[model samples]
Target: MLGGIIEFLLLKQSLPIGLSLLISATVVSLIAVLIHRLFIAKTKNATELSLIIMTIGISITIRGIVGILVDKNAHPVKPFLSFSSVSLFNLVFSSQYVIVIFSTLVLAFLLYFYLKKTLSGKIMQAVSMNSLAARLFGIDVGLVQMSSFAISGFIGALAGAVIAPISFVQYDMGIMFGLKGFAACVVGGFGNNNGALIGGLIIGVAESLSAGYISSSYKDLIAFLIMILVLFVKPSGLFASKDVERI
Candidate 1:
């Protein structure tokens, strides 16, 4: 969705970079919300299964659409920020990498604070723990779910924008990202945000080291291998409790 929009706006319409990205993000979010309301919200049982299937279907549909509308070839996005590289402790980092890291940290902090401090966040947490109890306590479960989906869409769009400049955008870019994200969640603990952050960092470092030492071609393989090891060792995830909750 975003790749197609960016390609169309930049190549055919000749829009400015910022505007194109903004429009793409907004459109994608709206479409996601619509899909959630139509397909996701209506599930009565096996909601997680429905969601997983729908998500995969949506991803494939978006990829197919983008391949049809835009060329399957990777498209380059103009650099939004440019600065000289900085070196510290014999390691060099680009300004863009710094920006991405800083942005991710800030977003994570903000999200943690929101989930810890805000009433809406509390309601969301409550719903996650027990939707029936949350509703019994007068919380709007539907609203919470919709808000989560909207936030997810926004964050996903932001991620796409951030990565597009560093790596060329392509129709199938979401596949690897989605897999890594899922692996991170699984390794971190399914319901723990901080664990997800830690897991992502671990995965990132592991992949980089694997590529640097072993083989660049096996970087992705290393990530999955880590995930499999984690699963085998701690199926509940690193941060999850051994005891299962009884609903």
Candidate 2:
């Protein structure tokens, strides 16, 4: 929601798409860091449930503020490409879909590289695996958490901006998107990025198939139905590692 609004505003000012995306993502990343520094980090002895409630409250606050600042009406975002679409394999696709796919793959690869090859990323992984143990090893758990939030915000903002051309910009649009993301995480295994990616692909394919073969109205329902089935069949998810603990 915020990302789409920011990108829309930037584009309205005639900023280049790439520049607007970079600035919007940077601003959102900083805001996420600030959110942790000012809110999450300040909580004393915060339980998981309390933290979750706090995040929900924060989300509502942000949404309400955005609604007031930006009109609630949906706004169309221009496509990144000058051309409308492209053809491949005897099929036509919106140019924005190509950009979205490319961006996802690039981001996923970069994220994998960072987590697997970088020192700070390793520290982050350590903290995520065992904060107390990481702290004992002289890692700054709080810093790692803040970095995690920043990365999440950056990626989320880019996602919103890239998809805006297709989905349009709306103040409250994040709700459904966030729900679908959670469903993806559930369908995949929590803490497993590979699983999450595959899970998202499955959901996306399912939604597309439903929209084609069934009523378009059943798209969302089909995604959740698949999620429910997955949960019932394997609560840990299809690719969940035996060692991976669920939260």
- Winner by TM-score: 2
Model 1's C-alpha root-mean-square deviation from the true structure amounts to 2.8
The alpha-carbon deviation from the true structure for residue 146 of candidate 2, after best TM-score superposition, in angstroms, is: 0.2
Model 1, 26: alpha-carbon shift in Å?
2.9
Q: Model 2, 47-69: lDDT tens per residue?
A: 99999999999999999998889
lDDT of each: 0.77, 0.90
Off by over 4 Å in 1: 1-21, 44-46, 88-90, 241-247
| Cα lDDT over the full model 1 | 0.77
Worst 10 residues of 1 by lDDT: 3-12
The residue-by-residue lDDT of candidate 1 on 184-239, one tens digit each, is 98788877788888899999999999999999999999779989998888877888
Please report the candidate that would top lDDT against the real structure: 2
- Model 2, residue 24: displacement in angstroms? 0.5
After aligning candidate 2 to the native by TM-score, how far in Å is the CA of 100 from where it should be?
Answer: 0.4
TM-score for all predictions?
Answer: 0.88, 0.96
How many steric clashes does model 2 contain? 0
